[model samples]
Target: MFYDHADQQAEAMHPNPDWTTTPITPELIRGALDLETTQHGVLPHRLPARARAQCTDPQLAMVESQPSGVRLLFRTRATTVELDTLPTKRTYQGAPPRPDGVYDLLVDGRLTGQATVTGGNTVTIDMTTGTAEHQPGPPGTLSFTDLPDGIKDIEIWLPHNETTELIALRTDAPVAPMTDRGRKVWLHHGSSISHGSDAASPTNTWPALAAALGGVELINLGLAGSALLDPFTARAIRDTPADLISLKLGINLVNLDLMRLRAFTPAVHGFLDTIREGHPTTPLLVVSPILCPIHEDTPGPGAFDFSALAVGALRFRATGDPAERATGKLTLGVIREELSRIVRQRSADDPHLHYLDGRDLYGERDFAELPLPDELHPDAATHRRIGERFAELAFTTGGPFTGHNA
Candidate 1:
């Protein structure tokens, strides 16, 4: 049962005396590379300090702190759990408002309950101009009651799209960090699609769902609008420990119009080279962009569909001309071809390196059935489809991330 945060005053005035308060610490957090002590609370960060220091873009900073796959993991017998959090929500200036981010609770790996904190902060964005305004507010408490009995592992999956700061944790029973389960740690990097974009909840994100099905611990480095093959991100991935690794490249590169084929090929090569320095023989998969029709033949620097925006809906359209491909501009088609060629060339010497065309996960036929709502990010159902497909292709027998190989 979800205890609504509407009773914020009551919760604050009459704290449950039977509950035990637990301090938020690095040990209790999973999927976050670093935890920063903020004035309000400990904030989980997806990127390490070094990588964050290299970039000055406010968007990257905001997304990294959104904690796409980060969760609080502990073993407990608590039937009631309450978490105090300050969630920074986002709103588009003229587009339809987004719902508050969700917190998914899992007991023994099964999703048990879901809740959302009522109020905290809001970041209003002007999509057309690329500007944002922040409004700070007070924290809210999320409570979950009537949990199943007996000692079990519990995971409080944080909001994937909200910048949440942990303020406090209270439970009826004691809690301890969950011990390693011997599952292979799968580290993945991609664009916002992998960052849980448009997904209903944190655990529902494609990477999260895939990790659950594959029985692998996930460390998602899927930064929204920031997966441009940055050297710092590559270095972060290289230094992180993982039994298997995958990089889903292309979409963000095209949408951002960050580089041409000339710059992209060498950057991709350099990114792989950096990762190989640390994980020389680990099963590494290179995935190209999924089926995005707008950028299939047309180059990008994608723009908002202003017509849709007029109706209070958010949508995107490729703005660059297709003829630009003649000048070595990148289109999804160009990326897919080049990625395949690069992987095939490198695999001759690097037996562990592998490739999967992203279209195989969400292809033209799939797109026809479940078209992308925004011409880019997949919707919740699409996230599930992509996740299931990834597990089947990468974790089953004869796959690069098969038990024997990973």
Candidate 2:
């Protein structure tokens, strides 16, 4: 069935015998943590090989491969471009099919075209049943033609929330890797907020928006629902090439109740320790959780608010009792306090390190006007707000991320 469908599409592409088919290698893509070659094409893993081996959590594996902030950055003189991809589209049983992942094409840092790939595959996930079924289909090609071409920097941004397997790239003219424009690479790690959970598109994610505003390259490590302070993630941060780095912590820990303050305190220390190992003097900012009213005082292990779901909508509520906070259990309010303390204490010895209360990005008053739609993740407008705030706070002169006096 796969071959049968693929052959039909191939015939269309073959009609233009002069089209150049180029192989996609690591050089062609940016923001992907790892690349694995497959018979169909290349599978880009946002987590590196070593990191992948350490954790066997299916959730982590799935989210990282979504390629939210990853883009195929290149320079080409072509007037037309075609990309083949096999995307694993998700369905929630009774829920309506999520919109197809969007491919955003940018020329010279400006939006030029948008596309969506058909065919490919589908993975239906039944949360109620706790099972998933994969149905394979042939790769589909997305074509964009007619452009004012005279050497342009092109960025093909992958879908924000879909697992995509890139198969091939074709163009009317030759393509080459885009030359490094001397932009500082900002490596960021955070929760679903940074992952673009409800973002309009991949390029609209907070990190991506901030990167655009700050004139920096983004390597997003914002894994959805899997930002548990894993040792492997810390090591990846330590090893990655980055001029500026930020770690957004706390929300995932509180929502999952993965550990108590006792374990969390040391885990935060250990995570920073590992990162400091590689870039001892890098500008590393430890950011606390953003303002989430649900988990502000109450502890969590957030649960789906079934009442809201019954009306064909998804909503979440903090399930952990507020009384649990009397013990070592964690909450956003508590985590913010601890993170600020830890950074203040650490910055005295390590000047390059900094502390940023995530509330500074999106706090109480702002929540009244721009509420988090899901009571958890920020909406598109909030991402823009956070991105603008981050650029003003971190990239401005005299900021921690900007060059400062020792």
- Top-lDDT candidate index: 1
- List runs of model 1 lying over 4 Å from the truth: 9-14, 404-406
Let me know the TM-score candidate 2 reaches against the reference structure.
0.95
lDDT score of residue 176 within candidate 1: 89
Query: After superposing candidate 2, which stretches have Cα over 4 Å from the reference?
Result: 1-15, 404-406
Clashing pairs in 1: none
**Per-model RMSD to reference:** 1.3, 3.3
**lDDT of model number 2:** 0.86
Q: How does residue 330 of candidate 2 score in lDDT? A: 97
Write the residue-wise lDDT of candidate 2 on 1-406 in tens digits. 0112344466544536787788898889999989988888898888998999988887898899899889998888988888888888887766656888888888899878887777778888776776889899877877777866699888999998888998888888889987777888899999999988888888888899888888888999999998889999999989888999999999999998899999998899999999999989989988898899999999989987767767767778998888888898999999999989898888899998998989999999989999988799998899999988988788888678775211
Error of 2 at 380 (Å): 1.4
Winning model by TM-score? 1
Error of 1 at 123 (Å): 0.6
